[model samples]
Target: MTRILLIGAPIAVAVSVWFGGDGEPQRPKDDPSLRISRTAAAPDPLKAGTPEQQRELEERIDALPPGLADPAKKEIAARLVASAENSTLDWRSQYGVIEDIGDGNGYTAGIIGFCSGTNDMLQLVEHFTERHPGNPLARYLPALREVDGSDSHEGLGAPFEAAWAKAAQDPAFREAQDLMRDRIYFDPAVRLAKMDGLSTLGQFIYYDAMVLHGPGLGPQGFYGIREAAMAAADTAAEGGDEKAFLGAFLDAGRHVISRQKTEQTRDSSRIDTAQRVFLRQGNMDLQTPLEWRVYGETFRIDS
Candidate 1:
């Protein structure tokens, strides 16, 4: 049986009430001055061209030296499109596209488009899943690679475990679980999306939970990417490479802190109220410390 941590309902309600106010709590607007402040930080490099242009671009990309066709580029393209479409379209239309594409093919296209930073493909996948409650392809592709007991990387495992746990608990997620358990998949872009989604939902609690769960799956889960990045940052810092350090820290911040904020904000009203009161009183006591911690932990960085 899964050991679910059941937070008390009354405490949860109290926290929500304390945070809620007259109108919805306004999130802090992104700082226009900071380049990375906005989620939509930049435009997609792979714009949808006329079919001719797209074909030409894909041919060029495919023809590149193997080393030149980095997966990150494709993933970024997909993300840019996803972010844009999320803003404009209703969910149902998105679902239709995914259904039309069918399994394997739609997912494969999405993976390529996303990795290439193609906005259209990314948006299609995001909207499709949002509209289709049980998107088997979306859910399974990430986990399918793991079944072989090979390619056991840490970053890959964390998302799989979280998804598995969530699917097991929720009946609606059963199809996702089934697909994941029995599919052949390969696409780093999809894996990244799954990780991003899990982080967004606050279900990737392994970071903190690992500290308590002993050095097993959760700790091992973040071990691959987190340790590699941290080591790289340390090496760069030692060599006085400020640029490398900054980039490394930014990546670390994304992996470690991004999910925590999403978890706390699951009940936005309470978090907002707590933040306001804590700021006004300028006190950091137990009653109000969580809010302050969230703010500092999320936004502020020590140089």
Candidate 2:
């Protein structure tokens, strides 16, 4: 399989030109000269992406043939998620990563590259333990917490590594991974899109960002992306336009995806550019018979 290497490594401040390309200080949104201001009412977080209501996109994704990703929602999302994490999609049957890939300290493993330095890895283990008590890794929760977000695998020695491999074989563990992904990425993106009047396509865009930058606020996480979009236009909750707000959000994501030169990310422009294609085509529902390219390779799904 061709490796996309499409996730993570986002650079913040991809595009922050306020006044001009020249080195100029940006004025506050309320700067009298700029005349930029928030909407009359508060920006709504709970209410968003309402267009998906009429779209019925979940049905469309369900209709896709097997092994085709709608980007970030269904089983296909898990496959693509694996592809993004390990540069391959067929890794569900494989396990044990002892080498550090310059990400999350070292030894990133599993479908989503659970690493010692990443807090999500700890959460994955914890979730697995909760479902299957007395699991080998259950005891390591304390050490996992202690070392969360740190590159140090401290107390997590060979036992933890072996347990990680063992758990991957368990169907329960696989289910747990999916559960964690949904809680952290898929569900939030869908709900947020609903509140913001976006469609499944919008929901997927949010999910992609959440997958890389965490569902919560990292330097350029979902909250920051939403914040950037909010700065541009009022959200649906604020009684502002929906299309305009979504455009702002995608633009912000585009900047982050393009933070490095096109060559560095292997032309990560695939993501932002593909979404732009859908937006232009008015495929808000993300209906299938889809085709797109990543890493200069074309992929399609017709069902």
lDDT of 1 by residue, 172-219 (tens): 343332232112111222221122221111111222221111111121
**Scored by Cα lDDT, where does model 1 land?**
0.26
Instruction: Give the Cα-based TM-score of candidate 2 against the true structure.
Output: 0.65
lDDT (tens digit, per residue) of candidate 2 on 1-303? 111222232222111112312322233243243222344332233232233421333333233332223433355454444444545545465444434554434446665555666566777787788778977679888997787666676888788888877777778887887676666556656554544445566666666666655543332556666777878876654456656777788777666556533343434534555656767778766676666655545555453
User: Which model scores highest in TM-score?
Assistant: 2
Q: Candidate 2 deviates by what RMSD? A: 11.0
Candidate 1 — which residues are off by over 4 angstroms? 1-47, 68-256, 259-303
- How do all models score by TM-score? 0.20, 0.65
